[model samples]
Target: MVENRPWMTFFTHVVLILGIALLAFPIWVAFVASTHTLQTLLNPPTPLLPGGEFFENYYRALTEGAKAVGAPVWSMMVNSLVMALGISFGKIAISLTAAFAIVYFRFPLRKFFFWLIFITLMLPVEVRILPTYEVVADLGMLDTYPGLIVPLIASATATFLFRQFFMTIPDELVEAARVDGAGPLRFFKDILFPMSRTSIAALFVILFIYGWNQYLWPLLITTDESMYTMLIGINRMLASGDSQAEWQVIMATTMLAMLPPVAVVVLMQKMFVKGMTETEK
Candidate 1:
């Protein structure tokens, strides 16, 4: 075993390096492409390294090209931020309340309700798209903020996760809370929720990423350019005529759109890890 340790270590290092490279390759390509001129990007296939004229490409893309899109990039970014955060907050709130009630309260047909909600997991958004679209349209919510945020409010996955985490908490703490004259609501607010902070944080990260990356729903619901999310905006930029195509701008815009989730992941790395481990426990 001792003699083979060196080979094992070398093999592990090689695997790790390869994994990192594979993960980073797309990002590297995007970054390099972002720095190239339109002429180079439009040429047969793009080059490997960043070409000269990074600033010129950025300037044209932002100011005078297909990616410009009449409105400022900042405006589009803010629109995306509001939509993503709204979905995140709304989803978390609904999931937490539903999970808490189901897990902690005794009520009629509770298990049935739980199972019914869980059944939603088997159905993809695509499967329900037409009905959901009709509902939103009938509500006159299409092409609006409420349309974007409300449909995502009840996440079955988040409810299941929170329920599982709540179940793992020691019953003794809940009993102690009851002994102190606390009711179910008070106990949930004061005891269960505080203990499940890590799990909540993890869910926030997951939900935020989901909301941020949502493209199809946004595309389908929003028809106005002013209401377009970053993803839709980028797609529009890409689909413009060949003469107006702006690859450098597309790369930069994509990188900008990617930054928020990346920042969230980095900032909450510890909480995210803790949440996963605590949920498992």
Candidate 2:
């Protein structure tokens, strides 16, 4: 039996509180900054408590955006959301089907194909970005949603993970599906897909955040203000040339940009943990 000691328990709680405070203090400061005016924020010691300008600052950020960022924060947020969702779902779909093909099909050079896909893990987007940009530009996908998402969607890591998980699925299950008159696609849809829900949830959270925070690729491809992501907008806000940066509006936009990814993680926390820790479906 495990014995609980009072001193140990007290120490644990103290550590936990301290860690929470350490992490949350910066976010609190940002929130406080967002609530104050630029002049107020610039003067002397920053306020720890929120100011009365919260609504004004946020409303302006949402509708008017910052002086440097041409697109409204809401439109940029929508673009980010679309890109994130498209990349997440697209990556998962392609990975799932590709893994299924590698695992179930008896095609020639099957192992070679799997290895070929696995090898792509070494070549990240940064490595081939030049050629990729060239292709996108030639196809007239620049400044478009397809340009933002298509080049980033094929995930070697996801495919490898799914393949490993599929390998763990018993051969008996496949035999049984065949005996039950289930075709390959039917078995994948009805059985494999449902069982991989936790994995999908985990990958969704990660890929959503990845797509949302994309900077270099989006910067290179999107010259148009209408297609700017939140990160791009924030960068533009900061680099507004000789004009003083609007601290309140910038902070407000930063806080707004954090919400969708935070919401995704919060809602999928349980599934994400399960997917990461649990191997067996």
lDDT by residue (1-281, candidate 1, tens digit) is 45768889999999999999999999988988988876787786778888787777666555543544655456667778888889888977888899998988899999999988878877767889999989999999988999988887777878888888788888998889888999988987888778877677787776787788988898889888778788888888878765576778888788778999889888988866764564445
For candidate 2, give the lDDT of residue 155: 79
Scored by TM-score, the top model is 2
Model 1: CA > 4 A from native? 5-15, 51-68, 270-281
The whole-model C-alpha lDDT of candidate 2 against the native structure comes to 0.88
Q: What TM-score does model 2 achieve against the real structure?
A: 0.91
Instruction: Quote each prediction's TM-score.
Output: 0.86, 0.91
The CA lDDT at 145 in model 2 is 98
Across 1-281, the per-residue lDDT of candidate 2 in tens digits comes to 16979898899899999999999898899999999989999896998899999999999999999998778999999999999899989999999999999889999998898888868878887888899889999999999999999988877888877888899899999999999999999999999999887678777777777788888899889989999998888989999899999999999999999888788777888765664464323
**In candidate 1, which residue pairs clash?**
none
